[model samples]
Target: MRRRRTYRLTGGLAAAGLVLLGIPPAAAQEQGGLETQLRFSQRLTQEDGTLSTTTGLGVTLSSRTRTEAFLFSVDSGLEQDFDGSALQQKDPRLILSYSRESLSSALAADFSYRQSDVDALSEDDDISDGVLRLDEGLLKRYSGNLSLQLGRDAPFGGTVDLGYSAKTYSETSDPDLLDEESVNATVALRFDLDPRISAGLRSSFSQTDRDDPGQDTDSASIGGTLDFGVTKTLSTNAYLGYSRVTKSTPGFPEDVQKGLAYTLSFTELRPNGDLSGSLGSDIDEAGRRTTARLDRSLELPSGALRAGVGLSTSEDDDLRPLLSFSYDRGLKRGTFGVKLDQAFSTDSDGEEALNSDFRVTYRQELTPLSSLQAGVVLRDTDFVDDANTDSRKLQLDLVYRHALAEDWNLVGGYSHSISDKSDEDRDHSSKVFIGLEKATRWRF
Candidate 1:
């Protein structure tokens, strides 16, 4: 079961890569800049009636360069914690891209690399088809893509994209889950029927392979979409497609799955807010899944509010629900915000789980060069199939920042956290830190 869940995590990475390919690259400029920061802090933790203290130092550096046809950026950070359980961490990332345009066509290529914790990444940050998995531990990921478009200015346009991604996980207790890799290719064509209507046809193919478990999956799909404006503020889009998937695993029978998929969506734009809804089915590394979502947002006088609800069902007859809401408001002297989220899904070990989170934060300006911030977070998780596995966590934080110079600052913070589990005693921890930070930026 763990191996199967690991396979699903790799599938999410491929889906995330496809989403990245869909976004247009930023235009190149002639300016460049560099920024760096350094900080020192102390932390304390208590567990099983024992308290421990740790000191840490952190540094971050980032630089960006842009030219006529190329853009590049590098960001890296290092942290060293000195204590009995001392853990040294390094996170480095790089992005490079080149784009060229001609009279009738455009060509672009991009490459990116990053090393970080796997749970820190989220597919919900972009457009996704409900294929998401949660995993913890350190990971290194590399991705590259090439895209070309012909006749972009004409009534008919065509685009071709090819991409590859690989990920390796570390710091895991289970060594059976190793590395994963994938390759993807897509071709799409669009025809402009008129100024307000367009039709598109797209085809995609991908292959995913994993080590340790020795499994390979191949998937292919073709789809068409029609987008039309019904009125100045209203629009409708529809898509229909079919997909086929084949999976091969050692010591098991080969599995083949085929299904029909479709998506119908509507959006309305207003002066103060917007509303959108969609229903679709698509084939992912997990075979096939159907999903529906509704989202709404409103612009208040002082801030904004947003809410969303979603539902999904997989080919294994498992159903899940997702819900989220957030509101932010600005007062004369302070800002306040609150957010709530709930998700029902499978965990990394393929266990059924339900998780809920609630958070609230407030910030106020004490003076022109000083501010105070406070926040609280609460989480509840329950494992449906596992007995005595429910847990709850609560955390509170307060921070004060004061500017001492143009490029230097002082920060003091205090945090308290508590965790309670079924059939176990409660654990508590508290931390207080005062740190000085220096930041500088240079432009060229």
Candidate 2:
């Protein structure tokens, strides 16, 4: 029921800005549509043996056209203890998103803003970094992206892309919640000598800034790319480049590294699937890095499967394994999916960590107007710089929905989660909730 006042104001202003941006002269002339939904709910939660109840309201608005779209949603309410005392605002949340794309050219832009609280086993909430925190806090996220291409079908063409993202957290004891921001841009030009062969030049720049001054870093690179068709269904791409990275930490001398970077990759297309493999080496703030991976995707009669495996080695570490796998199957009046991924990744603070995630989900249609959904998620994180900072998390969710009438539905769910860290006691949380939801849509 606690929140950051500053972040709330920022989210409100951002939402207003996006709404204003959604209404341009071009969009005003095109066919547009609007959809709204409202939900009222009551939830009961038990955290570490303490019980509380919440009554909440949720609202969503969506507008869209052929080339542009906008969405805004918010949830807020009041909560109290079993004794009906200590009433406070429910953990409030707000999200705003907008996207636009040019129909004639390869031009697109996307922007999104989110403000939410990090609570144990909360519904409709997710941590951006995917690492569960042992404590609770407020998190705000902002991101924007733009990309465009010139002369996509010409012998000579070019493309440009830009991206930015920032994540900030307040009122939390979690060590991994340090605020961070990143910016990236890339430009490329290509010329086609023949239908099956082309060459291009590319330049890119990226920067990562963190609340920890020691983690701030920037890098830039220039490269040449060649695409060759080996056969009708086979192709190869090669890149040769030079890159430089600089790290500046307070009270310490600046560190700079420059080196040659290169990559070789190939792809083969099959009747119903494809296979690809790549090997690359690069230099960054983390140090010199080399990696190789192979991936394959296949379409089955009633399902699909995709998997990948790789190995990565850095200047200061031995070879480490990486894996990715996902499978989805269609059943009679139902669907099921499984996913698993294990790789070296960076946390919100730009620190290196090993992440392993596994998830399984299932949905079944109980009747024409009723359905059931269930999921299980398991996650593990190990800091590369410290041995005592490992953590594991497990969560289970089950929900059932039944239509009561037109534009009305009944919803009930149960959720449980446990967090186990090497340096802290296990944290457990669970919740049960039932609610009614109504939705309507119209176009102008």
Candidate 3:
């Protein structure tokens, strides 16, 4: 089963490439190929000052047949534990693709089981999911393209009420995170109205079934996009979407909710004129909402300078506004990028929910045979009245990637992160990890 799973994972990727590259599935019989990858990771963890070690493995395989292509992959890992027990996670995925001139389709199945000795909390969870997509050309107008798809999704985004319930309504509260199995159907349409204008619309509906965890939900969403060109080099795009969800189970908390999102972006670069910016926002029915996000980018000789601002307010009587900036530069060797963001609130309760994060990414070529990358991340989050009211985290990562042979490659990397909370000294935690990957492919 493991070997088959690995092969399937690789076959799936190869098949996807063939389809996108306009190669017919029948080519597998004419010219077959193989793909695979193996990876391993070592980890160390410390919580409340105590430390432990862990290791993980991942395998995937992919290939194609005359009429179909398949992929399968599996991952396993263990974590640190305080009571002489740790965590085990096993995830396996399989995908199949079939394609023809007029019709192309994909089926994906994912199964995951995780056991953790949150020994302190006594909680265990197991979950699995399957998804399918079928795409067919409906119409090709001189102005647009249209397509439709149908599939299944296990647990998507969860509601706060649900999160709170799952936390067993702890004094501070955490909701239900379980979203029952849902079937989905959608249609997307894109139009090139003119050389200077374009538009698109997408809508989907979902029906859920009851499961062991919590209430089921039915939902639907519709969104549209419009773009216009002011000049040969200046253009703008606007987008809007609305969605709603309703609980299916009878006694479920009135899990009725609606949300709306919007975004707009503009760019101009007609010599001497260097301007680009975007605005986005979301509003939800529960009053737990977000207002807007604003971003601007400037052309610079060194690289690109970008700035952004945002607003988010929860109906729970909390309000927050945020701002940030970023810069990216490309060198002969690689690229370097950095950004920082902070959220400021109006009230004390809101203040506790404020958060900030800073990060830097740098990549450079170490030699003709290898490349290296290093990054650091720091973040602070206010948890309000939760048992742990605040969290500060810092992490560092380094990676060396290289090609081993004509059809082989290797990658080594390490990452470590730490989180600290005030008052609850026991809530502090840290994790260190290292990993290596190698892969080879053969063609026939």
Candidate 4:
């Protein structure tokens, strides 16, 4: 799977082209809407006894048709220190996204180019999903996904899913965080043996490529699935499969791992919610891994709740616990929510790491034309193989908005961030900002 680096923009372009072609010119000329927004802001930040001010501008344009949508946005800013230093660019971001959907298929494509001084990853961004570096710099990313269903109205049907993602860093010295590409595809064919029973065959393949040979890896699997309706509200599924994983390194021999894979799962539909549980084992470059999990969702008259718990073990014989819980409620004039989750994932180096995340959010209407929102998030990570790399991060945000007139609003916010690393000293920063935003929309 290891190969020399080559930048490929064909896949991204094709995805966009397909979406454009899928939209009929007649439809595009018919019903459509566009929205444009502009923002001007000034911020004051204090960090470690140093003060700075930043001025920023942002613009956004979006359009949507019956079956197609497009978005583009850009944000730029310049900062100056109180010590008479010249203004310097802080961080800038440009983003574009396109999506198209039909009765039997859906397509989504996104591209982002951003510069930052901190880690390029976000709270929801997975290091395992793309090529990412531990350090921060200019980053460009592209991703596209497509899903199709064959014979939508027929009893015998199948599904096909394809996804691709790539990442590249600009002017980076780190070999691990350079150019990277990933692709995955899955296909399934099903036949309805009867009204209560169905069987299917599935195959999947995924690969991640990077400049570093040690990080290049691929996995493939083929499986058979059986679905049975035990009752009107209960169903069960069983999958039996074989999987293989391969990895390459500079000095070590190519590692080819193979193993049997299987999963048994059940789902029960309740009056107000649902319950699901699954047990499975899969092979990876590291070795064979097994997991068991149960999840439940509950719907209340004014709120909702979801929870899950699981346990997993790998070839190393190390056991790890997984958990997730979330609750959200609507108030007369506000909303409140809390969430907590812990799960196992791999870093860019292909080493498994456990991550724990907790968040709380609240929003309230303070006046007829004003609102307030607040949120707090905490994240912790522990490397299974390297304890010295464990780290914790915290973020606090508060924002207030008041309508000034039609399509105009006054916005202010405060943000605080802190990071604690086992191998580095603690770091923290705080910022306060106020901005004016104007938005307009047109329909045709």
Residue-level lDDT of model 3, residues 1-444, one tens digit each, is 000000000101111000011112223333356555555545444333444454555555556655445454445555444457545332212223333221233333323322211111100111011110011111110111122222212111111101001111111112222223335566655666667787878676765554434445567778998889988888898989987866544554566777786778888774533566666664322223554666667767879887877666665645566778888898998888887766533111112245566768788888888887777766566543355345565655565566666533354444444445554542222323233333333343
Model 2 bad stretches (over 4 Å): 1-104, 117-133, 348-350, 386-388
Candidate 2 CA-lDDT value: 0.70
Q: Quick one: best lDDT, which candidate?
A: 2
**Best by the TM-score measure:** 2
RMSD of every prediction: 7.8, 6.4, 13.0, 8.1
Cα misplacement distance, residue 432 of candidate 3 (Å) = 6.7
lDDT per residue for candidate 1 within 79-174, as digits (tens), equals: 333333444434455677777777679888988887765433232222121112234466677889999999878989999999998878876654
The order of the candidates by lDDT, greatest first, is 2, 4, 1, 3
Span of ten consecutive residues with least summed lDDT in model 3 = 1-10
Q: Write one digit per residue (lDDT tens) for candidate 4, span 310-333.
A: 998987658888888999999999
Stronger candidate by TM-score (1 vs 2): 2
Q: Score each candidate by Cα lDDT.
A: 0.62, 0.70, 0.46, 0.68
Question: 2 or 3: which has the higher TM-score?
Answer: 2
Worst 10 residues of 4 by lDDT: 12-21
